[model samples]
Target chain A: MWKEWPLVAFTIAGQMAVGFFLVAGFPLFLLDGSHAVGTTREEGLAVLAVVLGLLVAAALLSFFHIHHPLRARSSLVNIRTSWLSREIFFELVFIALVAVEIVLVWGVSAASGLSRGVHVAAALAGILFLLSMIRLYMLETLPLWNQAYTPLSFALTALSLGAIAAGFIWGGIFILLSLAFVAAEIVISFLLAPGHGVYRSRPTPSLRPPADVPRYLHPARLASSLAGLSLLGAALIWGRGRAVEGLNGKEWLVAAFALVLAGQLTGRFLFYGLLARPGR
Target chain B: MVTQYGFFFDAAACSGCKACQMACKDRNDLEPGVLWRRVYEVAGGGWEKKGEVWVPSVVAYNVSMACNHCEKPVCGLSCPTKAIWKREDGIVFVDTDACIGCRYCEWACPYTALRFDARTNTVSKCDFCFEAIDAGGAPACVASCPRRALDFGDLAELRKKYGDVRQIFPLPDPSQTEPALVIKPHRDAARAAERAAEVANWEEV
Candidate 1:
């Protein structure tokens, strides 16, 4: 149970941090016809700092899962061949690029126009950071994580969260995009679900008795069901309102978060429970 | 004084620019995806109320890393084919020609730095830019970094420069391996605890 918590916590923290940064940082990138508003260069950079900091925190936390944390540095030696090494390498590079942007924003006296380029660079770095994170889970040995859609799913999740947060902050076309992403996530989740027939063997009966079986499956199944329902809710809200108003954005965000949390937890549980052990 | 090569990474001054990465790639003529060095951005602390002041302090530390080339290297110890070796200068190298493409060294290294080249069927890693160091030029990365975040010189000098300061924080866990690289963490006790908790959670799989 303790072991599972770490994975759960890390996933939650990572997703939340991505959401926080996206919401905090997107307003800076928004152009108002010919002008931009709502974010200063310093604030934009502070958001970058927060995002990079969170990613580093996530990376450092990942080290604990490894048997040897001290030798973690040795992982970098394999950039020539391993995607794992490349992932670490790119994460480091992305962090560095953000640092450069921060320095240029805070330390140097740069023009706002120059700062726009930095924003674009920061966006590119964010993309790299997300890609590196997805690649980290793409080990061929881990069948559940190794699927082609694993990275795609993760990327979509991040983008969905980011778009939702962006919609809340920016409140325009971003809302539509966020709703579309939510709808897409619902379709993906439904497609990805393993039906009862898909199981390689029968599920072990709950030793606690039949009464406990529903209790165990309730959260997972309900969460899965809620994911689809919430997505439909989001589509309805968007179609009727056209433009997000009142609490619409917040409702969509809350719904998306719930669905994603439920889906991810269910997926993680299934990954650990059903996947064949390497030796077995 | 006997001369030895190592890195002098100023944690305080490092802004985590990846020019070092680019420079290393250019100097080594590596393919697009290859990187001999990496920079890690480490941060700590959270918002806490100290009296009337709601202090939300966060500090960023940059770790520009490469092969630590420890006095004792596990990669060398675990390589069944004797492909990995340590030099007198405290640099670790992989003899590609002698490598059997077995990934044992990759698992042996805690740093995950040993890469198995499928095309060459060999293992490879940083050689500390031997040709440039031999010519008295700084390693390509050290020379190219605009911020001077990385400096390569005698290990003793680096120790002396940083010795008086508080020992670096969160040096990789010391149980399974001893890394030559030293880290100077920016955060204090509370932050360390938070980070430790975070790490504990991440290991779950």
Candidate 2:
């Protein structure tokens, strides 16, 4: 699983970028002219630019997953049939759409209908990108990853991290929402663990005896996430406006983000660890 | 006619010598961890009680497996690059130049036949000794099996020669891939799973 760091980094980073975009844009589109949780045009561009940068970074990291990076051009050759092809294709589409959003936001007001339309489109594309990612892992031969928890866990990863990151910039309310999602994600992660056993959890094929699912790392990941949730919850209860990094965000929020990120990283590594067999 | 190739294994006669595995590795020059053909040592069953007397009823058997070259190859169907494909002879081959080394096919395979070759930086598997087959010779593994446990022919021919019984203990359900394999199971194979038999060697394959 450690050897699959490239994939772990690629997926989480990509999902995080998409999550941020969707969560931040949700209030804007859902409500009629709601800047209540929106940033200024310049700030929007800055945020979009950051999201674009993360998307690019995630794409670049994924190159490390394949042994022959140069041959990757052929990956799109089978999008009609292969979920992996569809995954890469959608990711590229999402990235391109985000770049377009960044440009449109730079050119016009954030409140303009055209910019908003593109923003909504990009968010949908980001979602398709995530759906492709989920399908890519739900292989029939690999029962460990084939369960319902895969989609649940991935959806939570996107929503929890996205909601939390959005809360970091938008408002205290988003933080509370993130707290709920983080708690939910933690539960889904626990259920996804093979040893959780009561569910559809099946042992991955292995040459060795059945594996102990991340003896130390699994608990540590859950602990960090729980701590993040607690801190964020406490911040909503106590801190009104501390002004983190000149932004109307709490310092505790930033700390919680770091802790949550660490938890997600560890959890992803454990996810890869589940692949005991069925080819590799 | 579209000739689909296949393999036949007589598990009743196999002695688990592993020569077929070695022959395949040597022929393919596969890396240390890569195996085009593997022999799973399925052993299970325990003592049986017969009217207050204990009888040792252990079941053990060897199953030599390679690419079954399924009619519906999941690896090919799931390959993002279309790098894995089947010949008219029903032999699945990974295109060296086209494969991007994504290895999604590895996960889709039921038989665990596709192995990542570090040297080529791509997934590879048994070509069914296509060159040898075209020249009217058997695959290295089939030829090397001293116990005369292995055979190969057209899928229909193999099924007709040796009844179409592909599933046995430890082997995945045949419907998953519709693999072109025929097996003559060992007598103990019938009760292997019920008796708690499993592949004794997880490391060797």
Candidate 3:
């Protein structure tokens, strides 16, 4: 399972990228059809570039999950029946739409007016991409991942990370949402996940370790989650105490992003660790 | 006209010597970790008190399994590259040429029929010995069983001969993939669930 690290990185990075875009870009669409904001158009372009870069990097990393990279092109051949194929299809579309939106708004003239439409389209594609990613794991055969927890955890990761990234600009509302998501994730994983373990059920059991195995939850994963939430909470308090200033929250947000990202990576690692055959 | 072939297992007659598994591995030349057909040793139940005596209530049996080549194979449906496909005779085959080695089919198959081949960086499984079947010969596993505990034929005929029981303890529900196999269950199977029986030999399979 640890060998599948590339997949863990791919999914978390891709989800964070989408979350950042949705949280940071939505306000641009809401601000009365004007491009004016505290940050320069160049800065907005930089943010979009960051999101695009993360997604592209994620796509590249996912290639490592396949043993034969040359045959990766054929992954989309079964979109009709395969969630994996649909996931790749939607991810590519999301990336393309984001690229075009960036070009229209930043590379070309802002007077083109095509940027907003493209941004909206890109967001829609991102939503679909996220959905496909969630559905890919909600397989009936593996009851552990087939629950509401998979989708919920993924969505929460996006929301929390995105909110923290945009928290200073949006004030305490985004920060509050981030905390709420984090708290909910902790509650569910600790409280509700035990009953789902494989040894506990027959036909609808959760994914678990093989026989005579020890340790239900990995210590590293739990530690990472604690560390991440602590960093985010510290950032929240720091931002709340400081007077609003341009780029003041930027540094803290970056710190929060790095720590949260670490937490997400470890969490995803544990998620893959749950992969086990039912009988033995 | 979609002719389906299947295997029939008489668990009552099996002796758990693993001849079928060895025969399959030998015929397919499987590597150390890759097994197309596996025999699971199911054992459970502890000491029980029966009024005036303490009695051992252990129940044990062996289930020899391979790809059932189900009617609605989740492995094929979940393959992103369409690498796993079913023949006209309902035998599932992995197109190693097209497989990207994502191992999603391995996760999707409840029977865990698919096994990774590190040498090829792809997955392979039982093809129902299609080459021998086409030539009117028994599969190596079937022919090798000295006790004649295993049989193979058309799904309809196997059902007629063996009755409709397709699942035993630790085996998943048959409705998931509509596997074409049939079984004459061991006597211990009825009490397996109550006794908390599970597949015991994990390292070998």
Candidate 4:
């Protein structure tokens, strides 16, 4: 399952990118809202660059998942039926729109209506990309992935990661969302996930055993990751009130973001490790 | 009318001998760890108490399977590069030239039919021996079956020759892909699911 690192990176990075865009770009629509305070054009552009850069890195990593990188261009041929094709199409569209919006904002001005329009367009494309990505894995044959939890967890990952990365604290809304998502992910991992059946107290007799137990699935490591995430969420919420002398609020926020992102990365690794093949 | 080819397996007659499996590997020249055809040994249950005596309630059977070349092939529908496709003969074929070896179709297929070919850096699977079929010969698997438990012909002809049952224990529900293959189920098949019977062999194909 570790062999599927490319997929794990691709999905997480892409979803985080989408979430960052949505949270960071929301202020473009609020013409006279004070809640958009501290939401500057430069910060937004930086986040956009990060999202695009992550997406490009994700695309490159996906090439590693395939044996023939030279034939990667042909992956877009089956848009009529394949979710994978739609995913690529929407990702490209999202990237292109984001790039154009960046040029408009940087070359023109942040207050330009045209850049806002492009931002909205990119957001729509990002949503499509996320949907396509979800559908790509919700295959009926693979009982392990064909569930509502897949999309729900992915969406939550986006919301939580994106919220913090975009610096949208929202009077502790981001922290609460992050905690809630972490809890939901824990619940899903133990209960709703198809692969969770393997670790059941009385596992049903199946063709194959739980393929491999990765380090992240170890009880100790799982608990530690969850605890780390909870502490990070608390720190983000508490650190906002107690300002360190040298460390600015943004620095603390960045630290929280890095920790949470690493936790999510480990969670994704465990997700891929649960190999539940149909027959054998 | 398009001639949709298919296979018919007499599960009652099969003796678990892997001649068909070997014939297929030999015909395809598959490398180690790659199996185009596999025979699944379904085993489950144990001794059960029947009043005053312990009865052997155990059940076992074998299912030799390859690609069914289903009418609605999920592998074909799921291939991002249009690498997997079905001919008018209903034989599903993989285009190594187009396949990037992403192996998404491997997950999509219920049969576990697709195997990664390390040598070619692509996915490979049973092609139903279309070349031999075009030359008016049966597939190597069918021709080599010692018990004559396997047969191949047009889908309509196979359906007429055998009953309409297409699914057995450990095999997925046929509705997903509408697999063209037909089967004469083993006597223990009905009880297989109830007893949590599963494919027993893991190491060998």
**Model 3: colliding residue pairs:** none
lDDT of 3 by residue, B1-205 (tens): 4399999998988999999999999999988888888888888899999999999999999889899999999999999999999888888899999999998888888888988898899988998888999999988889999899899989999998889998987777788889989999999989888897777777777
Which has the greatest DockQ? 4
Please name the candidate that would achieve the greatest lDDT relative to the true structure. 2
Residue B44, candidate 4: alpha-carbon lDDT? 88
Model 2: how far residue A277 lies from native, Å? 4.7
Which residue runs does candidate 4 get wrong by more than 4 Å?
A: A29-38, A168-173, A193-210, A215-225, A241-255, A276-280
What are the iRMS values of all candidates?
Answer: 16.4, 3.2, 3.6, 3.3
- Relative to the true interface, what fraction of contacts does candidate 2 keep? 0.59
What global local distance difference test value does model 1 have?
0.54
Q: What TM-score would candidate 3 get against the native?
A: 0.92
Model 2 misplaced regions, further than 4 Å: A30-37, A194-213, A241-249, A277-280, B48-51
Residue-wise C-alpha lDDT for candidate 4, range A93-167, written one tens digit per residue: 998988887787678866666776777788899999999998988877766667765788688778767767654
lDDT of 3 at B203: 71
TM-score of chain A of 4: 0.82
Q: After superposition, which runs of candidate 3 have C-alpha atoms over 4 Å from their true positions?
A: A29-40, A109-113, A168-172, A196-220, A241-252, A277-280
